[model samples]
Target chain A: MATSEDGDFLPLTPVAFDILLSLLGGEAHGYAIMRSVQERTGAEASLHAGTLYRALARLVETGWIEELERAGSDESDERRRYYRVTGVGRRVARAEALRLENQLGAARAHGLLGRA
Target chain B: MSHRRRAVTERLYRALLLTYPEQFRERHGDEMTRLFLEKGVDARRRNGRAGAFVHWLSGATDALRNGVGERWNESRQSRREAGTPTANARRTNERGGGGMDSVLKDLKYASRTLLQNRGFSVVAIVTIALGIGANTAIFSVVRAVLLQPLPYEDPQELVLLWGELRNRGITHFPTSPPDFVDFRDRADALEDLAGVSTFQASLTGDGDPVQVDVGSVTPNLFSMLGIEPVLGRNFVEEDGLPNPQGALPGQPGVLPGIVILSHALWQQRYAAAPDVIGRSIEIGGGPAEIVGVMPPGFELLMPPTAALTPNVDLWTAARLDYVNSPRNNVVLRPVGRLREGATVEQLQAQVDLIAADLMIDNPIKATAGYRLRVENFAADVTAHVRPVLLALFGAVVFVLLIACANVSNLLLVRASGRDREFAVRAALGGTRSRLIRQMLIESGLLAAVGALLGIALASGGITLLLGFQPADLPRHRNRSHRWTRPSVHGRIRYRRGCDFRNGSRDPDVQVRTRRRIEGSGRPLHEPVPKADQERGRRCGGRVVARPADRVRLDGAELRGTEQRAAWIRFRRSPYVQRRPSVRPLPAGHRSSGFQS
Candidate 1:
């Protein structure tokens, strides 16, 4: 409950935020999340396998994400572990987006951005 | 992708993942491999093989950076928690509570105690000072006389070749010119050989005429010794050859009159003139041109006889008429440098064979008891002084041991008085080893201070010794008087004392002390004391007299007849009685005997 008001996670790493944004839709395995991040960032902020997993492990530790258990015996790829954003993770992502929007509005007031 | 290519790509990624830490690899190996394989297929589908390669490169770099970073953070965290271990556990694990910190504390405590007991401190310090001072002085003398190598190239290969008359019990008689030439030419083991003869020359030109020691050496002497003159050229073959036209206007059929000045004489007579070379000076009443100036500290080859001056002031060519000289004239000392890989025994064997051949060639010329003797040049120079030096060294070492025992006894008495202090310290949690260490540190501090004082005293002692050293003692200007500093042996003795004090009843300490005692046996093992005894027996009950008694004054006022009577009367006096044991035969008489 205090996560959204204090803005404790207002400054998320580009890769971590991107991973969170990619998992916003639904549960996805690690490889799918990496592809989604590359696609969403237009390949400007690509997350490699090692960087993705390291950030994923940290996010899970901070309670911003959780590993989802397999429900059925689909067993197509047993090696892949799925991950999803927790309720706190969704709030932190919304707070970070608001913080960025406020910075952009200030930049516009000072005419630091081109008219668009 | 083909199955084989996919398998190869998976294998490479797995190998790269192994670089991570064991805990990391175990938890994440399967997941990492699956992600990498899925990305590889997607990358190949999008951009082909090059895309897969790029993905692999980025992933590998990221893996390396994070893997190392994680392990570094872990170690830092562990180190931060290291101090939380229990005190007893830490004590057993660590060698000491605080290595350098404890030593500093001990040193502080030691100084305080020593200052508190000023009277005991003075006695212990003075005793150690005397012991260390005497040891240092004697060791310096021994080092100078025997241990230091001669100032020459390959000094060990240099030897003195003396002709011996075994039946007459004279083992070091000088070699005759013919015998030297024979050995030089025939002995394959000798690299080079030269002869030297000492002479008295009166220097007359620059100032008042003064008698100075001169060495008449063969032309090749400097070359054989591997020494070069500091100024001008060494003697050449032409200098030694007899000139049909004499060097001066009146003298006829004389050798080329060339002389090389020693550095001391050069400074004294010439006032170190730059143009001293090529200048004519009077030597033995004859005009001789100065060819060169030898460096300082150059000593001439001469027996350790007190009659001769300590050092040669000048050098000249022997210029012997080798072909016409009598074979029985044995006045020149032969010195030879051994060839590479040649042993003294081999050279001696060769010289003996040559002597036998010479004896057979001329029966009357070669004496019946003639033989060859080879001796190390350095050993021969210090032969007479080694015994007296070793004896002094032994005496000083014994005195030092007695001093050590006295100081140890004093320390024991003092320590007994401090029994209560130690008990109190133990009650305050001082371990047994810690208490022992504190005691050792106190003794070590005392020894260090004593050693510093001892060095100061030893330097003064050395200066005093050198002042009284005999002029004929072989010495060099480059030799440092402070060659033996009292550090190593003093520290060893201090260590032994500390061990003894710490555990008097410990069997290990007893064994260590015994071992140290056995290891520190006499350093000089030669029969030097026996040689001293032999010399005592040889010179016993003889009136020893100085050779200065033979100095005679010649002047215009004293006519020839009166002067001769005065000289004869002076010689016959009881004070100048002929003592064969002390006084060597006069120079002229000895040379005459050699010629006979």
Candidate 2:
């Protein structure tokens, strides 16, 4: 169950939404998440380094994501700080997806949105 | 890229990280630097040589933007959590906040706000800096060139004499040798007169052949100007005699007599040796002895028409035979000092009488349409350049005005968002004046930073401008450190002193000018002074407001132009007879000497 406080975090900003969706698949470092989001967005040539890091930091601070103790697969390299989404974050993502679906369904019924 | 280059790149990235908040830097600084290197490597491998450049450009911009954003958010979040307007500094003074402690807290808070809004602060500062930098640079030029007081004793008493043809629209032409003598003898209004002319001659017997600007001056010139040489003796009457080459350089006469070395030349060539006064150096193939060394920072400050640059390396007394000199061959540009209680108007009246006498006595003067005038030496030298400096100063002032408007607009935007903060302070017993004072503190902080940065930029810009060193820009190149406030004041005062002289004069001359204007069937022009334009306004005659350097109206396009008199420039020394290997100053180059 999504907490009311978690619902207050929605509807999500576009950058925050993209960042959460990318992190949900598995634990990943900043570069991997940046690459994944860039591939999905397909417009930005590459994700801005500052934008990716800032969003990741905010998500971790918000308790919607957790930074793992493991720095990277290469343990010697301290820079590859990795992160994963939390249970509350996953529930919130699902709730947002459902809400978007209901809005689209209403739009399609009203012919505001049409099937391609 | 080499390994060393990669190391430097990494270092630069680290330095850029300083813009981020300390907490953010501690948490992610290493990761970002590592990611940037890897990202750049990947980009270069995929996209060729330019790939690395693009990566650095985008990465730096991204870092700057996000660092500022994160800092803003940091401040915002802290304020939200604290749930109060006052910070640590203000809290210390919450009790009895009314004096020095209150002032200190206000300053601290103002600085804190600027630091928090890093992006807005940098943008505002840079905009103002650019405007002020440009203004300062232009001010440096105007200061050195047109606005500086002429460095001479009783400078106001000094006057420049010129012969003009009102009908021909030819003015400020140099005087002939005989004519100069005539003026000297006949003009009682003047205490004394001295002539100087510039020539490019070689120092042949020195270590190597070096080109130098030499001034041939009337021997008593120093005495008239109250200047004494720093070393050795001033030129005696004997040194004033024409060189052995008779009236001209190529004529059979003694080529060398005595020379005075400029202070800079003394230091450069002779190592400022005190015993070097009697040393003989061959000038233009003549054995010339150095009799004196001029004081440092002494150079002829004259108008471009006089063709005297401030850097003249050598001075020699002219030996002229006035009786035998041709009246039609005009060449000498003379400076005259008035007797005590004498005025330029008095000298002008005397000069006009002499010109009238010459027209009655000689056909050359009549045919040439001779008209004579005198100008305040300071006003005359700065005439052409003053307008240019004023325009540049005006332009930079406009730029500064626009910058101020932009900063005002930025402050308004920020203030609108800060209403709630102000409200909180007010509700907690802050008066309206206190809030205004706080706002003033913030603006004052911004101005201080902007002014400092602007001055730094100006110093660099002035150095760069000096490197280009346009020929007509006077007094500016040598004094690199002269960014003084007094120069600006001088500009304002100098403007008033010159304005009255430039106003309407001589209706007879104006009538001739009107006739000339009516005479020009086509739109042909020669250059006219800004003063002439002012005179033309009152005459109801057309004047080309901005004339090109290419002078077109010779004898007002009259048929008998040869009678207009040839201002023959004789290269007097046979050794100096050879044409300069380099080309003449390129077209559109502002010449300080008379140009046809």
Candidate 3:
């Protein structure tokens, strides 16, 4: 039951938004989320492993993310902690996407960019 | 990556992970290390060793920034939620509730109350500022001129020896070269003695022919003072002997033409050349070799008064022909450093014995009333200004006392008004000492603020006083730094007694003022009559009247009747008058009795 007040958190820090976007597909361990961020950004926004965990700790404190119970499997690394974005995190990510779209519209109006 | 490198990388990442806050590390330390090793391995596989190094570098920096930032934000949030107490309150509670805690609480309460009533704080602070500022300024001057040790080794043993005529009431007369030589050789109590004289010399061949004041000192002057020249050598014993025949083109019968340039003169004329030591320069139309450059601010032997220049620009060796110089030609001023364990009285007794011997040997030259007077060099230099400085010191101290009394009275009134509050606290089991402590804390706060402002005022006040100070005032630029220590100690003592039982009736203040007033009056009453008699003797004595306008040294006009009077006084001595055929040569050409 994410409230509309979650929309007020539209301006996510770039790294935090990228982390949330990486977790959007599914629950992922810290390494998978870091690798996903690098792949999606063409390795331009590679989050260091320590930096990724610090952001995750802040995101958990803000209630925008949660650590999930790791499934016990023979190949799974016992040290890896898996995280998933909450419903509020997803809603705030959507609000941020909308805000970016409006900013793109304003830039297009001023002839600073073209529609892709 | 190789297994060895990978193992090292993993260990390094684990150490870096410890930089995070303890709680965060506990939750994610192992996970963070696993991810780092995975990234390092991936980077090494993709790019190579440089890629892994870059990854660690960027990762360490990022972790440091974000980890510290997160902890700071967390603590700030908790503080906001808990409504954190002020620093004073935290200090009190952290001390575990005792006398210190109560004092801290009282200080906090007093500061807040004073802030609410700003007018009283400002007035009291301003009053104390003026008082403390004036006192500090005068104290610095007095300390520098009177109390501070002279810039010499074992300064307490240093003294000025003057030939005094007790019957004529004439004290502090100059010494003759022969007498000085005799005393230096005969005196057992003195470690060493040196004579210094000041005169004008012309510096030519460089810039405009500028007349510079030169000091002619004995070879032992620098060694006696325990100072070395910044470059080259001090005046060696050989340097003081007359130059051999045909050593220089001009100035026949002159001492070896060697000069030690003052630091200022070296910079001005030679541009502080490293080769200045061996170079030759024309002084008074004679080429003199530069033997040394004195260190900067090395002014222990400056003339007490000079008209053309404030400081001596050069030093030369005083080569005295004791055999030819008359015993009564009293021209050199002798300064001596006593040997260890030798008191002034012992030196005085030795000096008296020597004076008696000289009188018996040269009965015509040495008057019956002649005696040797030994005075501390610092006292002799500062005797002229001691009265003025003492008076100003007294006046400022009185002002500080008045200001303190007024502030104490104001605090008393405020404390009386807070009687009901104190009574209420006492009803709650607050002891009498606690109430007094609170009052004292309030006074301490006020005094602290006042002292801070006073120090600020004093810095500016000293600069202003120095700016307008008389040209002849004995100036020491580092004096104000010395004032800070004693004034701070005084301020602490002031605060200790701020709320003592007799705060309103400080007997010490009354007694200090009485002593200072008596001290100030003594200098004015006692010294004035003696100084007046001395001045009358100089003016009305049988010395020849040489007009100041007629006296010229190296084309520089000697100004004032005082200079002329001094010159006449030196020349009219029994020995100089006895040699009537010998004319008094200009200072630069004189064979003996060189004045610096």
Candidate 4:
């Protein structure tokens, strides 16, 4: 984890932050991103199948992730679609991570982290 | 392939097939199945359990995608076709490529609106349903009764002949036997002349003696009406000749026992006996041989539903003899078929001249004078009930109209209430026509619900009408004759044909009774029968007063027509012709004589 100095930053929802962080390490499919997020958090987060697909579809529609063709497979296998984060997705994710770091840094400076 | 493994694969295929649209199943289901199986085998090889599940999901998604893609292509094609100015193309066609999307959006909106105001929607639907149901039920009755044509071949040419007894102001009198003979023999314009009369007789054989209506007709009746028996033969021409029980070549009036049964009678009583021919049945204390069965629903024509009804279960042939002199007996309804090209006007003219000549020959009988007219037989039968049905139809239509108006008013109010939502949508770029269409869709949904409810109500009403039928109704006679309660059976058993079903009855001959003076048997010019005098005494009684010895008075009229003619000689008459008597009445019990 990295920390920032400035306290002034934007607010982000936990799920959105987690999803963005999961895509940080590498490009991934929807299920792979979900699996990555679950491993790092060490916590179970339940998501309905429709909800998961809807979120991925929205993300793609909003230009955050782009669809990429599979390298080599049976022509009929559409479920093995690959996705990669866009420039806009990377910027949003970076900005969210920096804002969380800044809040953590302020808490440490105020001696509220370990002292509490 | 093992049976278990094949079954598993088949189950997965069925699950995946659901993701495809219905149209795909109809068009290319087999081809798509082959493609799915080919891919499934490869997927199973590469993947374990989890991988197999993923492959299944992929297959399902492919099917869905194909459905969506096909829809998109069809819409595009439709848009291209619409661009061409086809004859049936909508003017100002707002439904371009995105018509499906817009209609779907409207449906969604309408559903949502209905859900929000569930109470209003229910009330509107119920109201409209009741209104529509009543209209449908009554209209069906009207169609069956009034609108349907007479079930005869070339019924348009058939006509009814009425005899006018001019002296008694009796029009539409049943033709006397002598008059009928004259008409049948003298008339050249008509192809055939026939007569019919109604009588009651007890049906004795094969069951307990039960009363049944009997329609006696001249032997040539069926030939004149242009109808033939469905199972056997009709009356032959020689049967009506002057000889009694005369046997013509290929004809049997030998035993004087030839009659046909109606379809309903045959089905119920005879159990559809195929060998009913030459069977003996007792009617009116006489045995008649059953020759044939009339077609089902043939009762739609004569008396008792076209004489095909079991109202009169048996018909006997009327034999005409020239020596029988019965004038003005007025018992038989005469009908005839005109010659190929003769019109009613021409026939009526000839009939009028004949009638005038007959009147000139007999001065006393024709003194009062009457007029002659020709009417269609079908019209005469249905005239009684036609007006009532037409009135009911008019009333039902009013109810439907009121329902429509009420629904429109409710919609108008709902639209005004949702004005704010509409304005927001308009600001967001929805057109006025789109808003109107959405509102119409909501109304249509309400209408559909109402229609279903109305159907239920109508079915119930029909049951009620059928349950409470009257006895004299042409349809509910000996055939299928089951009795419940008298009230339930009082609805005038409707003929299966629409006319009697709608509560219409045809007027038969009118009976007029008068008394004749003694010594000469000649009718006298006298005042109408007094109600008080006729009520106490039997009809045809004379009131005589004895003052010095005996004063005789004549009672020349009877009140009740069906009552047998009788003579009553009163010992003393109450009223004096010219008398001056002085009697003073008390104040409270005063007599007012000639107040004017």
Provide the lowest-lDDT 10-residue window in model 1 chain B: B587-596
Model 4 C-alpha lDDT per residue in residues B124-165, reported as the tens digit of each score: 877777776776666655555566566666666677787666
**Candidate 1, B346-430: lDDT as tens digits:** 9999999998898788775365578888888888878877888789889887777666656665565465334335544444445
Q: Model 1, residue B466: displacement in angstroms? A: 3.6
Residues B503-595, candidate 3, lDDT per residue (tens digit)? 112324334334434443443223333443343333232222222211221123233455346446544544222233333322221111111
Runs in model 3 with CA error above 4 Å? Answer: A1-4, A29-54, A70-80, A100-116, B1-116, B205-207, B243-256, B269-287, B301-310, B340-343, B364-368, B383-405, B408-449, B467-471, B481-483, B486-596
Q: Which candidate's DockQ is highest?
A: 3
- Candidate 2: residue B480 lDDT (0-100): 52
Ranked by DockQ, top first: 3, 2, 1, 4
Report, for every candidate in turn, its global Cα lDDT versus the true structure. 0.70, 0.69, 0.68, 0.55
* Chain B TM-score for all candidates, comma-separated: 0.65, 0.62, 0.65, 0.59
Which pairs of residues have clashing backbones in candidate 2? B241-B319, B242-B319, B244-B253, B244-B254, B245-B253, B249-B572, B304-B592, B305-B592
Question: Which portions of model 1 miss their true places by more than 4 Å?
Answer: A1-116, B1-102, B205-208, B243-255, B305-308, B361-368, B467-471, B476-479, B503-596
DockQ of 1: 0.37
Provide the lDDT at A31 for model 2.
78
Enumerate the candidates' DockQ scores in order: 0.37, 0.42, 0.51, 0.03
TM-score for the A-chain in each candidate structure: 0.85, 0.84, 0.85, 0.71
Ranking by lDDT: 1, 2, 3, 4
